[model samples]
Target: MTTDDKLVYMANQIARNFEALGHDHAVAATEDHMLSFWDPRMKARILALAVERADALGPVAAAALERLRAGVVPRPQTGATRFAAVDESGASDAG
Candidate 1:
């Protein structure tokens, strides 16, 4: 399949996976997933496809793409940012 086609399929799959979360949440999740996992080139390509041929994408995916195109990106937390140096009990494991 063409790269654009693959991107559409992938976006749809991501949308499907997050659909159980409900509309708003699913769109956010799909957007976050793409932002965190897809490279800049992939994102740009998808954005172009979103404008040129959005009907190929699922509803949630299309919404997410529109959001991305509009610069409503969610900041993805990296491993270091997601994990705290202190434990949940307020104790540090470092020596």
Candidate 2:
């Protein structure tokens, strides 16, 4: 799969975990997670794919990507403790 596809699948998987929250909440949480965790380049690539193939993304993932692309959500603060809990891509959070 392409990088965009992998990110889409990963985002969808994240959305699935948040699914029980219901549609709107799930999308919001997913978008927040992406803004807080994903690298800027990854976000940009996904945003582009989101525009080109939004229907291919799951509903929640698509909505989240749209919010990211639109600048509706704020990126996490650099010194925020929330980021301490999240490992960067390909990095381990393992003890």
Candidate with top lDDT is: 1
**Which number leads on TM-score?**
1
Candidate 1 regions with alpha-carbon error over 4 angstroms: 75-95
Computed on alpha carbons, the lDDT of every model, listed in order, comes to 0.84, 0.79
In candidate 2, how many Å is residue 74 off?
Answer: 6.9
Residue-wise lDDT of candidate 1 within 14-34, one digit each (tens)? 999989989988898899988
Model 1 pairs whose backbones collide: none
| Whole-model lDDT, model 2 | 0.79
- TM-score of model 1 (CA atoms): 0.77
My TM-score estimates for the predictions, one after another, are: 0.77, 0.73
Q: Pick out the ten consecutive residues of candidate 2 with the lowest summed lDDT.
A: 76-85
